[model samples]
Target chain A: MQLPVLNNTPSQAEHGAKGGCSASSCGTTDNQMDSLPDSIREKVQNHPCYSEDAHHYFARMHVAVAPACNIQCHYCNRKYDCANESRPGVVSELLTPDQAVKKTMAVAATIPQMTVLGIAGPGDPLANPERTFETFRRLSEEAPDIKLCVSTNGLALPDAVEELSKHNIDHVTITINTVDPEIGAKIYPWIFWNNKRIKGIKGAKILIEQQQKGLEMLIAKGILVKVNSVMIPGVNDQHLAEVSRVVKSKGAFLHNVMPLIAEAEHGTFYGVMGQRGPTPDELQDLQDSCSGDMNMMRHCRQCRADAVGLLGEDRGDEFTLDKIEEMDIDYQAAMEKRKVIHQAIQEEMDSKRLEKAVKAQQHQQEPKLTTRPVLMAVATSGQGVINVHFGHAKEFLIYEASPEGVRFISHRKADQYCGGDSTCGDGESVLQLTIRALAGCEAVLCSKVGYEPWEMLEAAGIAPNGEHAMEPIEDAVMAVYKEMAAAGKLDEKNEAVRANA
Target chain B: MAVSIIDLCVNCFACEPVCPSHAISEAKPHFMVDPKKCTECEGDFPVFQCASICPIEGAILDSFGVAINPPGSLTGIPPEKMAEAMAELQSH
Candidate 1:
């Protein structure tokens, strides 16, 4: 996969990691593999954590059905925008249920491993029964391979459980910060339901009561439930262990402890109060401390309402929220742009090499010796040839400065070789190319020539005088070539190769 | 597996799901238990799966009406967790 090499400087992971990935700048790459989502919590644990080998992988995309939400939370206000469009946040484009279905199909095609389909935030799915159910209805009808998951504050869950069950949605994640209604109310600014702004404690109590009911409903129905517990320092961090205890007792399968990312500018709770986000370690300790009873989800990205893919995966850098309709175009354009950046990198490396080669040939100034003695191979008949044993990419750099337009003559092309060829034009065998390169040669140098070529060449009796030992193809060839050339022995057979070329 | 529904059953289908084969179903006519698929999670879990999470009492039962474990009894966890893990693996 030629991903965009946004950072040519190369990342530490890329240099030493198994994938040999060259892209280091993309933030998503680091967070490529996330904790299994709550929906697939149990099912995914059954699958291999890695693909055979421990290769980091990306999660499937999730599409948010924004138009619906049952009980409104204080923080949620969905006016769709594909804003910066890295993940699902604000939908840049909204879609009809039919349009969403088609768009998911298109997204699945473009992103090969679109494992789970998701709908979260904007509004609870149960609240906007018309839009949410229709989206789920259409998705199940069209593409069933992609697993289904939904996240809600859990307000309208009870009423919608049967519908979710009918579609066989295997996993469900509900965000429950504090079991306390007082705290819950403080967290949420307002709740709009049945056409009214149920504000403060009133709305909080209603939403919490309803959400808890929803969790109970989901558990009773056998839908695997995962509890997303956000840790708001000084708020619910201390109460988290109790949250774990209660949910675990209720048959909740897992608890995902997430850090509250206070959107300072959003005028949200922490932002208006000028509170900073938890240091990663502080959040992790809280998660670890409260992870017994249930499989704790440590790797949650807390993706925007429109988040898709495995837990914590942002498609690109900026958490994006595209309207379900524009998912296809936005993703494709991002992919294409990533490709263009990749192509540009390869071209740069090649040009850099080409420039160096030209400068070496024109300068012809023998490099001053710094360490051991240096050896240079002159253009013998301008058909400079070097026979190789094992072709490696590093072999080409030796003649990188040779005036001898060195032509590599190989017996068999090796896998992953940088440069070498054996096919002879006019059906002659590399005997011709090697002969051309050996033309006017003082001595033909190689590892071990086969009996036939050896016999024919030794028949000329150009003394085979050169140092020999186990070494790389290029080094060995250069060693023997320079040693033989310095000794200055040649004969009639070498003249024949010159004429052929 | 004739059993009474317990208080803990919010009726979330978490239990009915992992039942090996197709045994547990919806709580209709009092959330009946199908003994056929109720290997008591022996196919996976070592003890009665229902009791593990049955917030209420006696949600799971044998044909003879014995609760998987009386509420006051020691937890199904064997004194040796590793031994239980090993024994469960052997059963499979």
Candidate 2:
């Protein structure tokens, strides 16, 4: 499939220099804009956080999709409504990728001004990689125009940056409080990586190194990087200038210095122990101090993980999960609607090529496989047609058949696999559960199945037959059984268990 | 009696903005209503402002283990009535 072009373009020095438009100067050259890759241009224009001017005209919505954090920061407590508030760990609703896509489409439709879709976190986005990337992949196809951005604490960024680039994620916000491990230790208590907890300065050092490495990798790929520093009073406040210098030298596009929200109510390790927050003047002074070559982002809202609407003005309440579910909105349809439109255009182009190829080959027909009978499972919507998707199929119809006839033996009920929502369960665990449910069956016949689950099922000795054919389930089952029998692979019981073994 | 905010509280600030005793404060999981200061709006208002203004039902609970603002409270359509209405609509 041809990649969709990113529509929004930023005419900034960062776009010129850091985006590989020009290496020598910050100013845009005559051919710089034209020479820039689609990913960088699209990200620069649509991401409100990166483009200061876009903040005024274009709105961005954050879906609190990632709900797990790999590291513990003294300032963070990842619950509450981070989408509506500016804090990192707070979010009103935690959505799975499916839910996030639905909500994003709904919000985007209702609010025409929304141009960017971001996953900022009630927790570190990369901490929950599966949910985070699945959302991105879905959104890339469903809402291609909406620029994608993700904010992480850099703990999991190293492992995730390459994947993020693959998804065409244009903007990344890495919260790097300080480069110094001694200072980082004061901010972050522990980091959970590779299934081990490294605490104190050691954890801080590892996190810092990873964050820097991740930042370099992202910039090398021409992905715009935004560094966010929470100006913690008496902690990393004095060292933010050095942070800006380091990140800027490493090709960070912008630096956002937000004041630390050290309220007594949060009972944060720092807050309870009377850690003070930087004053407005102190924050401004820090930003000003670092306001040299690196563009200083002075108007950060410190948005919540599930924040919606424009920057500074939060409209999260209007689109709460319950309210959205109640609305007569076909979110799945809305997501698919764009794809159908795009497919129509693609199909039209391919039709000519297909016709030419058919003319050249004279449309030679391939011979069918020999007839045999074997027991197999078939997923059908209704009327004995293989119509339903494998993941969404709730039940599989078991049939035992040969070349002569087929018999409906029984039906096995299985859980519907959902990818986006963590509440449903991880895709791997869910797929395993599904495979176990279909144990003893030689093969499963469905209209379509995802590649990942298909391979997994194949590994477990179950063949996934995805013909996506509009034929009677009996015919489909009989054909496969006949082929097995013809190959002399069917057992005495007319099943493929022995052949598969 | 003080009203307590459970984890279900979305932290929409509906409760915090309308609290009379200034008891509601943002917390880690959700907004917390201070039992020390919470009077359940006994003298402040006829209905608790936080509970009344909350969008999520059953998010705020009174000390008696009952939801001050139960589901259908935000929409003002009781669950039973809504179900009946839905049933009637589906029957058609």
Candidate 3:
């Protein structure tokens, strides 16, 4: 069987993912992070952050205080609505800063995980300083512990950079793909300031000017800056190296190279004439290329402003915007109440099972199918001379790539070395089995594992893969082998695990 | 047969004015990326400018199927230098 592509099993990759993607990088180069003052860089590396399924857990509020933006990009319109929140063909509900704050507090009382607060949206946050700062001030006084994060086009960030540093806000995401104004004109339609509409080349100029100034200011003030660049195939892809160059020079810490997702709903995607969206593979590949000096982001979930919880770990979108508003005041309390409901459901399931069993008893013609399977890890490596572990069995399996290719030669009867476990009992025997299995062939592809087994594998310079649902053994083995091959790690055919044992 | 555009466009316009082979047309409410003329931006820039500029994540996708860069994943000389100094690196 051929290896199914990544799209076939996304859940295995991203569902509360703790580790980084082995293949995709976050477009972060080395020079910027390495050159940073150890104090600052360490803060960044250790920063409690997650992507895709990983929620910031912190509740962030974007007071639509910055109701107006001076600059307009092709991808943006000062529409009374945002595409992320509204249904397609529908518009976002606009709220004043004061109204927004009231709603925020009311919502915060219910969610214990709400921690961060800031202004991020349609217009630049700093553009409307009075409303933006006022919202921040009120939130600070009200929820002091909550961290603040803001995303901006960086147009007016320069003027307010000092003010931002003064505020308790610690994290900032600036959208800057091209430092060159020539290309910038295509994305941004215009920039308005002092009652003047700066069009075309001039608008791009203003944007670049402000982005440079803003990024520098944040770095100087020691505020962690994360630069977000939209990966547009024809427009700025050619120039990302330039973007990477400038971003690194200015001392930016992280680069989020997000793929461009055009939608008629957002108004950001202007022309729908004949273009297509990027496949997942293309996005991962692009992320691998432009991720200069620092780590590349493989796991950008393109989260909503109000997105809640951790990646892969968040079982479902239960904390979604619609669900939260309709949920009970206390979320945990509500969840506990649901557990009660679940317990009731389990009792109902047990009753059904009992009924089915009784029916089978009455209709005795059908045979009862009771198969309590014993799971075993057979090592086909080498024969162990010392205990009954005998490692050679593990070696035999490594030579064959297929189950059809595998032929068991010997069967050993247990009841010999007994300490506890059945089949084979001795701890030494178990060790031999594990070591031999680890040596033969390559990785141990199984359903699930805990830290204990993972650690044992690591100690012996081994790796582990757990793709729970992919059926039979052949499919899983082939897929694992393909990925290993793609990553350039499949060793010689003769490599066996049990030989050392 | 005339090259036809499909219905999956999202108005990203990643294929506009970037027709090196000059095969693409203007976006329709969005635009269609011309693959034949794409040449994958072969002789021009370090990467495809259209794909880079399309901010609508995946709006301007890689039709040519060429692998591009991500953030901070450079293994060799730096990522930027890889493109600008492709010749130099290749010779080495």
Superposing all C-alpha atoms, what RMSD in Å does each candidate have to the true structure? 27.8, 25.7, 21.9
Docking class of 2: incorrect
Question: Higher TM-score: candidate 2 or 3?
Answer: 2
Q: Tell me the tens digit of each residue's lDDT in model 2 across A63-83.
A: 988765667777764333323
Candidate 3, A59-126: lDDT as tens digits: 33334445445555554433324332421112243345665555455445544444445566545666
Docking class of 1: incorrect
Error of 3 at A277 (Å): 4.5
Q: Poorest 10 consecutive residues of model 2 chain A by lDDT? A: A23-32
Which prediction has the highest lDDT against the true structure? 2
Q: List TM-score (chain A only) for every prediction.
A: 0.52, 0.58, 0.55
Ranking by lDDT: 2, 1, 3
Shift in Å, residue A253, candidate 1: 0.7
Q: Is candidate 1 or 3 superior in TM-score?
A: 3
1 or 3, greater by DockQ: 3
**Least lDDT summed over 10 consecutive residues: which range in candidate 1 chain A?**
A47-56
lDDT value for model 2: 0.65
